[model samples]
Structures are given as structure tokens and as C-alpha cells.
Target: MKKRIVSLAMAACLVLSMMVTLSACGGKPTLEEYYNSDAMQTIITAAVSQYEAQGVECSVTASGDELRYDFTIDIQTTEEERAIYAETLESQMPADYQEFIDEAKSIKESVSNETVTVVVTYYDADANVLYTQSYSSDG
Candidate 1:
């Protein structure tokens, strides 16, 4: 069984009733043709740079497009020592883990081998308050 390396945010995705309301006024590049490149270093650098500006610790797991792309991101620490935070979350993340698993199962049910774009960001103070975003091909 592939222990899908789900991102920390994805693992804490318990906001079923809390939906992100984005009023897409149309402008961002289409998922289809936007990230279809092999310049992973460039792409990752950009994402990391943008996030780092906001005082974030980041790591881009993978990158590509319809053919290949990132699937998971591991969150290390927020602002201070990660050891303490990780220890605390490890004990309290069970329920969140279950919810995250359920969410991944749903995504698996709905998605195919379709390449996905994912970015996982953990808040410096709150491990549960992670920012995870996924992008699918331009269908």
C-alpha cells in the first residue's frame, strides 16, 4: 500500500463546512498550459521564494505537469523549534489524520492518473492552519 505522502495541511483538512470562497475574476494562467514545463528548479524556486517572503519554511516535493508533477509536501516547523511542535501535534493529530485520509480517499475516487499540482504551506504558529492548494490539468 502506497502511504501516499500527503502534505501536513492535507492531513489537517478538517474544514468540510469551511469552504474557501474564491471569486475567480479570471486572470491566473489556466492549469492546462500554465505549468507544463520541466523547469522544476525554477517553478519550485518561485513558489518557495513567494512563500519565504511571508516568513515561511517551505519545500516543493515535486513538479511537472499533465505528464508529471508534485504530489506531496512535508511540513517541518513553523517559527520556533519544530521538535516541540511536532511532539504536540503528533498526539493531537489523530482525528485530523482521519479527516485528511477521508479527504484523500475522495480525491482518489474522483481523480485518475491525471497530473496534479500541489503546494502545502504551514503557518509559522499553527500547524493545523496549513495552506494546501491543488491544481489539475486544463480539461
Candidate 2:
């Protein structure tokens, strides 16, 4: 009887340990939820609204691991804007584009001269990545 009791106790301990190890805890963070999340979504919407006030058209899109925030703006775009922007962005420009460009290329690459930060989330479940969502938050 003593031996039998000892064996049963060991078995219970093993079973309990196994169950604990098999259980999954919490959840993986995902981008879909981040963009869809009301809190984060609201922040992005407000920022976009402010940008729209400047006559810029923009929207946020996320798919898989890719995240994009597209924006287009209309400006009087005098030589002053380009000159000022060029001077401001001069230090940051890559060696390739450091030289002068034709008017067409200058206008095309102008927006690329600016930078913005966006925060996104990715979620995983059952050892598989579920979805990704992205949104930009105001600093």
C-alpha cells in the first residue's frame, strides 16, 4: 500500500506538470487589431484630419508585413519651397540624388524627402501569425 501510494503521487505530479506546460498564455500582438483598435485608430484619424487641413490627401494601409501611409499635398510650390526644402534636406540626401535633377524628377522626389514614423502591431496564435495592423500616432 505504501509503494502504491508513492507511485500515484508521482503520477499526479507528472500529469499536473504536463498540463501546465501544454497551456498557452495570453496572445500575440497583431497589426490588424492595432489599426482597428479604436484607441489607436482615433489618434491616426485626428492626425490625418490635421494634415488634410494643409490640403494634403493621405490614407493608411497595412497588409501582411507591409505598412504604408500615403500622402499627397498641393502647394504653390514656388522655387522658394524647393530651395528651402532642398537646403533643409541636403544633409540627409543620399549621395546619388545630391546632384541637381530636372524639374520632373525634382517634383516626383520631393515628398520622399520628408520622413514620418508609424507604429504597427503583429499578432500570433497557436504558433501561427494571425494578422498585422499598422497606424501612425502623433508624437
Candidate 3:
């Protein structure tokens, strides 16, 4: 009877472990959820510091399936720098979350040379604009 109980307990443990593993493999979080995540913010902050050259102020806002990253650089960044920044942002997206970026309804990025305002807007899958915000530079 003792041996039988031990075997049964081991089987239960195995089943519980499998259940936990399966739940962990569930689908990734939505873009809106990830927008507020520390991981995303850290990645964006690092990328901005890398590309801004001088200095930048950044703000992030998110609602539902929408996310906005707004930043300002001290100087009027060159087009090359903007391209690099965008690419770096793309690369920083976690692999599992890349699908959210790919399937987004729209992505709009505007950088102004006159005032050094940067605005990035991302729309949800339903064609609704998630959010729009602005960034400023010191210069």
C-alpha cells in the first residue's frame, strides 16, 4: 500500500508540472499590455539614449491595443539617425511580441526638424488610433 501511494503521488506531481508548463506557453500579451511593461520602457529608454546623441525627453502612453512613444532630442536629428532609431526600436521588440508590431493596423512616426518634436503613434487591430503624444528636445 505504501509503494502504491508513492507511485500515485509521483504521477500527480508530473501532471501538475505539465499543467504549469502548458499555461506558461500560452500566447503573448497584447501590445497595450506590453506598453506599460518595464521591459518595453527600458528597451525604449536605452534606444533613445543611443540615438539621440545629445539628450532626449520621452513619454509613453497606452490604451487598449494602442501605444505611443514620444521623445524629444536636443538637436534636430538627421534623417539617418531617425532611420537607425526606428530600426533599433524594431529590433528591441521581444521576439514573441514582434507579431503585434507586424499585425498592427497602422504605425505613424513624425519627427520635426523645426522644433525637434517626435511623435510615434500605433493603432490597434481594429483601426482605432491607440494614442498620440509628443516629445521635445533641449535645443
Q: Best by TM-score, which number? A: 2
Instruction: State which candidate, 2 or 3, has the greater lDDT.
Output: 3
Q: What ranking of all candidate models by TM-score puts the best one first?
A: 2, 3, 1
Candidates 2 and 3 compared by TM-score, better number: 2
Give the least accurate 10-residue stretch of model 1, judged by summed lDDT: 14-23
Judged by whole-model lDDT over C-alpha atoms, candidate 2 comes out at 0.40
Candidate 1 residue lDDT tens string, 48-88: 65556656656544333322222222354544555565456
- RMSD of each candidate? 13.6, 23.0, 18.3
RMSD of 3: 18.3
CA displacement after TM-score superposition, residue 117 of candidate 3 (Å): 19
In the range 51-113, model 3's lDDT, one tens digit per residue, is 455454555565543455655444444456556655665565445253334323212111112
The runs of at least 3 residues in candidate 3 whose Cα sits more than 4 Å from the true structure, single-residue gaps closed, are: 1-25, 73-139
Top candidate when judged by lDDT against the true structure: 3
Off by over 4 Å in 2: 1-25, 75-139
Mind giving the per-residue lDDT tens digits that candidate 2 earns over 1-74? 67447644654455344334433433322444434545445545665676677775557664443345555444
